[model samples]
Target: MPALSPLCLACAAALSVPGAAWAQAAPVTLKEVVVSGSRSERALDEVPASVDVLTGEDLDGAQVQDIRDLARELPNVSVKRAAQRFSGVSPGGTGRDGNAGFNVRGLEGNRVLLTVDGIRVPRELTSGVFGSASFGRDYYDLGLISRVEILRGASSALYGSDGLAGMVAMSTTEPAELLKAGQTFGGRVGLKLDSENDSRGVGLTLAGRPSDTLQWLGSVQVGRSSELDNQGTNTALNSTRTAPNPQKDEDVSVLGKLVFTPGGGQKHTITLEHVDKSSEVEAYTGRTTSATSGSVLDLDGTTDMRRSRLSWDGRFRIDSAWADELRATVGVQDSDSREVTHEQRTVSPTQRSRDVTYSEQLWQGVLQAEKTRALGGDWSQKLVYGADVTVSHMDNLVTGTGAPSYERYPLKRFPETRETTTALFVQSEFATDRWSVIPALRYDRFELKPRNDGLYPLDAASLSDSAFSPKLGVIFRPASNWSLFGNLAAGFRAPSPLQLNNYFENPFGNYRTIPNPDLKPETSQTLELGTRGSTHGFQWEAAVFNGRYKDFIEELVAVGGSMFTPADPLTYQAVNRGRVRLHGFELKGHYALGKATNLRVAFGQTQGKDTVTDRPLNSVNPAKLVVGLDHRLGDWKLGAALTHVAKKSTSDIDTSGTPNQFATPAYTTLDLSASWQVTPSTRLSAALRNVTDRKYWEWTNVRGIAAHSPVLDAYTAPGRSLALALVTEF
Candidate 1:
């Protein structure tokens, strides 16, 4: 089938001004503003892309404490959660790594960009001897976030890199957001409890305006939790155990911001943030007796992560006509992850220990400007230009006392590498009453400079690359209540430092990973068409998108040699693969059933395949349909949500692992929630999740698990659970 030529012609026609009356027709007003879609505040419907915004109230009502919880509320978004079966010698990707980042439109990991307050978040890391260490990208505290915006589809035209699939932007709360009119000081305290994880949490936020020009805000959140519950019932101490391993978790997050407005058309904000999370696990599955010949007795492990960031941001209303506003931001961030494992065996060595640590330090700066101009005949245009520069240093170390002949202690998996990226972008929007055109372009240059010390691998080398991203969007409003939009965008992701220089060799095992300095960046192009309308208290949106990705970086592809050749270890290198095609559609709407009641519905489905091999992509999520109903009377609100998921068929899976993978069955779940305003400044919310206690597994979580494993039940999601929260403002 050919592309939509009519839409293409219409977009081409949009370049020339249409003879439509501007003041006669009024577009539908949603009254909701968003910034991530276009890097400027605009009506939600005005953005020519698929975007979802979750406000603080939405987060509080849903009890979204982490990224895993947040995924339940969005369509075409998923987070992979493996079982707690990781060991010191094996930190498999399918094992206990917590929430392993997000998958949007079948693309995940470092392909998606995540940011907070315009500052980039650190990428996920998983590299060491035999992949024994891993770090995820869940360093956010929902309590301090005022809003989160998700932009679906390619976004590299604006963000430069790490936006090949999508972007998640978060904005923290401001002092004025919590303060009432004329109030000098205000704050909120919150307490939450959830049965799914047996977790307890507390959050405190304070804001004060000492003077007219100065305002400050501070927030702190703390949580303590145990292992998450699953449908598994077995409590055995060996590998047959179906229940979650005994675990303890603790986390703390702190944020501070100061805003100053000296009345010279300028405002400046200083921000300080810190987050720390730690977890300990007792690997009962690794415990065994000497008679079993398991060669192991006990195993205990702990993982610790910490991140700190400081930044200054300035916004100014420039006097020049061409540049109406100017914005500048500079920041420094540091993140560290450490994993320690101890094993006591019944074998000759008796005891073994492994300690691994990874760290990343970054400095970044951004400058941006925006302007709006009026053309003749009621036509108008807005221009946005920006520059971004970032420099980062990363290093990883592994030390162990497991005196295996082939294993050595105190070694570097990847040498210290300095990464730098510089980019410039410009976007323009031209609009009239009936039509609008948006075009954007960005250029980025990235360089990786490795410190070639003694730890550096002789075969590894530095790398430099560049990319150009561009996008075009067109919107045609045929009626006052309707909008038809089309967009074509390009995105790219540069290869990671570790992927280009990682060096690992196990002579005894006769397998090793070689560096690939010639690896190219992954690139993608997406075409989307959609329509949105509002009428009679009903708002709806439907979109269809097709994307093609090329030069996918496949890590650890067998390049030469054989595993049986001890003298010639099997060589595996990162290489670029063929093309991938993914297409999907989403439908969402909200309807006002009555003066006090509302109904919501959303459905999404995606299909992906390797164009060369004609094989289905396992990262693609199955179809999902969600329905919700809400009613409010006075200060009490009641809501119910029903979710139905399609089953994963055998054909959709790529079961080539040592243990064949299983297919998930279809399932449906219902949730009920209620919120009551007990007092003028106090509120309470409660939710009953998985009301039916149905047993089901998320495809992303069990993608690689053994089909016939006795612990299959361990991969099932939490059965019936309850969450409660209380908040008070003063």
Candidate 2:
């Protein structure tokens, strides 16, 4: 090596410090690697943002039912599904269950961006007159994932819109070609059962390399889960009746992928992937009477949902200065949901039936280039840039069935809508010895066009919006085992088509939604500070973030002003609101107690308020803590965990309107897990959740309704559930 420059020498000196090794120095494996946040493949300590990487081992030990289940051990994270407590979407438990969406640091819905294998997941949720649809309705089958990386805070600089809170990305499993030597063909089969809802699932995975230039992986899973009921104390005659009952869900999914590589001066790898999934849900609330049998309410509705995806990825690596690697991807996704219901009264043989269909289709393409170069002696840098385009289309149509005497719903709640998005992003990483810096920028443009079928007030709608997000992060390693980090990032979300131009009317409900074309994108600026260290058989990370949101887009109750008011029906128009402040802190750590035992703790707290109104924001999460211990004995591992959540006052639940939605009391539950490796290729795992069968409610799971209603039990937490998992590979 030649003489290094002064800056290079300084960098070398900083890196030379001897510190306790994190997971970074370990031999890199396809299945086990602690990652830096996305945009690069760096170690955790090398990244400035708050990043958490869960290994396959960590995921399996958690007995995760899905990706959402992993939130128990992570700070400031939760999941959301449909709730029946409120009319459409509310807090508490929605009697309905759909694809579980992510909520990070108190922000849920389309605010959190989700991706798989670096590809953006499509937004499936749309808005309609009756009920708005959700954006992400497809779940990442856990069985196919090898690693998951969670980046907390604004990530729009790297992922574009929908990353207002953070980004979650998972890497799929590799083919058998990357497996240990001498394994020509291998597969894993598993069976799991949950006591809470008598849920059961079977998973099968197969990977193989039949030739030197080809390798492949395939997975299949099927699951069924019943309703999770409360202590049954709410069924008393005096309790306020809840409309729809708990729902039963059955789901099935299949995934397949193939990879091929060829030799030469330039190596190229091509991959093809596809996935199909469907869920059938039965609304089993059954016929029930509230306080008294004053109204005849018949309940028998089944919802059928189907989603599919197909993708192609190509990569080329060559020895060059302009670019070291070029990667490209093309993918498509389609999702459809249908629900049918009928209610009849014998008094006059009056019948009401309706068929509802909500569907979305999307196509996208991405191209990226990566380059690495030495910057004078010890300093080096990696530059990554990418461009992507996406087109999304949605359809929401409804029709009446049965007798004409019954009232009929609107034929079109939400009109045929299309959104086209184009974006260019770039990120640079410069590192020397003890100092690492990253700056990223992304520019996004959205073109939205919604069709008018002669049903709404407008003939057609055309809108365009653009945003620029920027982020800068720095990491300083003062000593071998400790590092200080900080990040300033900007994020934004464009208004959904429904919010921009939706016209829905429900004569019976006395409410209507009028579009607001003047709406602006929701934007945020966040500043974060944190420190992470690992030494003396212990590791810890702590970070605090403060953010301000501008142009907050929300559905506000409109009384008048160029919109339908008391004359028509109460109007809930999507409009931009005043500024809001969001802040939160998180702490996590683990200590190795001897070589066979480990103890860990995770705590998180968040607060959000409207700066203009000085009132609490409904999007905040209650403070929570999770403590756990694990012991490993050769091939057997035993662990226990306790989750405690603080109670919330009326302010905690976004009392912008509803108070009961935020009504949650303090509660604690214990969980235990045991896993055994019977043989080199076989493993068995078991978990006892809510060992006390405690009755509690999570503010994030259900929509808000009055607290004293009988529906409370429907949204209550599951009690005394035992889950067991058995997997064998050969």
Candidate 3:
């Protein structure tokens, strides 16, 4: 990819002024919309935080198919596929099990919380109980999403648990004024082809609203992608080689949603949704030595997810002097995952063996109510109270030709685990003519219970804890076009079930992980300051933040011999560490050259260090920069963007007999796209990703590969791929 030329920088600077025009058209104006901030419609400038809104039109113009693709265009965000050597899990949990995780300002995984219509989705996990390759199975189908709102920075004080990093809220289509007038339908069909992987796939989506008070959206997609063959797979670690020419894989997904609203004086709404995904692939382990041929493995997996929600919202006027608006929401989610694998030996056909089949079910429920009141004096208060409960059951069934054919290993069913949390939060906004002060507080109590179903011997059955978090912020409007803000907040995360109950093997030898029943919750205190403003054709935002973490939870290696009747060789455990400090900055802005052209740029950097070790934290993120140019003509729109990722240094570890720590090299990529209005109600578009076919490792997967690994030879990022689609509405 070509570097940003000095001329481009000069152009950007010159275009930053109000009323500047680069072509024969008027400057573009910022649209006024409220869903980006508060639940109620309010101007974007009224919100005191780092927020970005991507409109439905923007998504269509970009040909965005998944959340990962959508993250690339957002400010201070990065998304990458998971490492191949790391076990087969879906990349960045697609908002499920939390495996395929997304990194923002260096924070990844559960640190960042994702929500659909205010409902939290579970993260996906690996068979070993680690965060799944991606968060959840593709629960986020772009076809059903009408808009997306991203709020960056710590928000745990307002949202419980998983909001420590930030929050991503996706809003699905509903039957509002935009669709209530008449029956409307729309759909898109597209195909993509890649050069390096020789991969090909197609996708389709359809949605419609038939009545004023009802809307329904449904989508189904299936695609086949060729295995990524990188030369770097020829490495050996502890005599265990990586995979080469890994078997290709297939993915299928289905999503449906129904939304209903009553047109009575009393306001009420309900939504029901379901999502499913499945994948199958053959696995290949790269050759250990030059003389040995690789092994071929077979694997099959399926994930089924179901969610139902019923909510009611209404307002009551107690005397005309004051009024109160109330909202109550309740939801349930059922998720199940199953996987099976078969390994084939290279030397003897009969030497084949199979590992145990793994399966688990997750059930969750949430009830919440929020009330807003008008308190006369330009002062209003909002109170929110909620309770959440989740139950999970895990079963490990040993099945295969190797198992005793007659007396199969008894199904090992771990005790069912249950988690319950209740929280009370309040936020008040008091404003004068030119300034606003917002103060918020949240109190949360969490309880966990583990039931032993005769699967494994465990003594402790339950644990509980509580926390109080607070936030204070102020926003000042120095001028009508400018605003300045600052905030101080506290965040926390309770231990997840897997973190407290998982027992797995280590790479060293026959090892086991003992659960730590006595673990403290992780907490962080953060301070942030920022400014935003818009003038005619120019809009800009910048923020700086610092945070301190306490009782940080991390996986620790136990030195002593395993403690078991059989006395296993090695052991590992989860422990609470001392403290960590992190700080970062984010800057994003856009300038309209004219009605026909515009330019936008965003950049972010974060640094985290352990107070005790005085070293950078593991997987700390690197700096990132994205620049784009958009142009429009008669019924046509075009865009080109360049993204740069900085190098990252791994955390320091002294015990490593051979330290595998190093810094990832920086790289850049380019993307181009175009969209055409075929008719008043029809549109067509195309996009080219990795335009230069440049190879680079996303920071998240760098450690899984070898040193000096060729970018293309590692996990390739859809090299030089092209996609085209058509959409029509009536």
- The top-ranked prediction according to lDDT is 1
- Model 2's lDDT to the true fold? 0.70
lDDT of 3 at 627: 95
In the range 1-730, model 3's lDDT, one tens digit per residue, is 1233332233233212233222222112224574423344446776677777877667773357556777776656755555344232212211123126566655666677777767666653443333222234345556556688787776765676766767778876554423334447655554544433444545555657676655666555565555453435445331243333344545555555555555543344455555454444333332122334433343222333333333333322222212233445555555444443444434344233333333445444544444444344554444334555444443443333443222233333224567777776555554554776666666677777776655444453366887766666778998988999987777778776556665554333456666778787787777889999999999999999888888877764474565542455566667787588878898989999998999999888888877987766655657889999999999999989999888764443221322554456788989899989999767888888888877666655444444553333444344577766666654
lDDT of 3 at 351: 34
* Overall lDDT per candidate, in order of appearance: 0.84, 0.70, 0.58
Supply the TM-score for candidate 3: 0.81
lDDT at residue 111 of model 1 (Cα atoms): 86
TM-score per candidate, chains pooled: 0.95, 0.88, 0.81
Question: Candidate 1 has what TM-score?
Answer: 0.95
lDDT per residue (tens digit) for residues 1-730 in model 1: 1133333344344434444333322222224489888887888778899988888668873467677877785789888777777765545423545877888878888988999998888898875443556777877778888898989999988897899999999888899888899999999999999999998999999999999999999999999999989999989876677899999999999999999999978999999999899999998776663444536678888988888999999999874755777999999999988888888876666788878888899999999997766666666777788999999998888787874666677777778889999998888788888988888777789998888767555555788988878788889999989999998988999888778876778788899887888888899889999999999999999999999999998877889999999878899877899589999999999999999999999999999998977888888989999999999999999999999999998888766652478889999999999999999999999999999999999998887677897779988999999999999999
Residue 12's lDDT within candidate 3 is 30
Error of 3 at 616 (Å): 1.0
Q: Which candidate has the highest TM-score of all?
A: 1
Clashing pairs in 1: none
